[model samples]
Target: LGNQAKAAMNAGDLVSDDLIMGIMAERLKEDDCKAGYLLDGFPRTIPQAEALKVMLAEMGETLDCAVEIDVARDVILDRLTTRRTCSGCGEIYNVKSNPPAVEGKCDKCGEPVVQRDDETEEAISNRLNVYNDQTAPLVGFYKNEGLLLS
Candidate 1:
């Protein structure tokens, strides 16, 4: 769903929560998910979380736990601000923490490392704002449902 959302954004289209939910519903019907599956980037919003509950109820399953990885906003900003990617290989590196062996060069192919426009401070802050507005409610919703583990 994250890739779908990213693709939609890159294409200048609105990503519908229903579409993402539909994809999740389809994936849940697969045999592997019948036993169990770890969802990394689904149920991002309260509505999606509720939709998931209904879907799982229909499948005679319930969520066992949900974990939230906590990180400081400043840390996120700092990390994103320094992120650089290789245009040739699409390999990502961090200037401050994990820079390539040669400055501004890709370690894999010696190609120039460039900062992705989306990784800029302004773009990152905008994305973070959207995340806070839309995705934050799932934390409380899951907590109320006793599904949140941390």
Candidate 2:
């Protein structure tokens, strides 16, 4: 779903709410989610949240709570700025939190670890702007539903 949305996002456009909801609906029906599951990076809008509630209700399930990890934007920016990813193994490392054994190298694959294009400051800022614009409202929406737990 992420890759499906990336092109539009890179063009500074949002993937339509219906498309995101459809992807979520299909993924939720997989065998892994039969016993309930935790959702993150989803339900970005009030409608999406409401639709999710209805969808789960149709399956005789419902969201019990929503968990939010509160982090400062500056901190998030700093963290993303230092992340290094390996193309060979797709392993990730953080310079501050989880540095590799050798500088500029992937410990697992011996490949050069590079910052991904999307992790660049500009790209990260764009993503943050979109999240703040479209997804931040969910904080209030979930709070009103008494499901927001930060």
**Residue 147 miss distance in model 2 (angstroms):** 1.2
Determine which window of 10 residues in candidate 2 has minimal summed lDDT: 1-10
All candidates: CA RMSD in angstroms? 2.5, 2.7
Question: 12, model 2: CA deviation in Å?
Answer: 8.6
lDDT of 2 by residue, 26-81 (tens): 88899999878888788877788888988888978878898878888898899999
Cα lDDT computed for each candidate against the true fold: 0.88, 0.87
For residues 1-150, write the lDDT of model 1, one tens digit per residue.
768878998899978978788778888888887668899977778888888898889978899999888888899999999999998899999998899999999999998999999899999999889889988888888889888887
TM-score of each: 0.86, 0.83
Off by over 4 Å in 1: 1-7
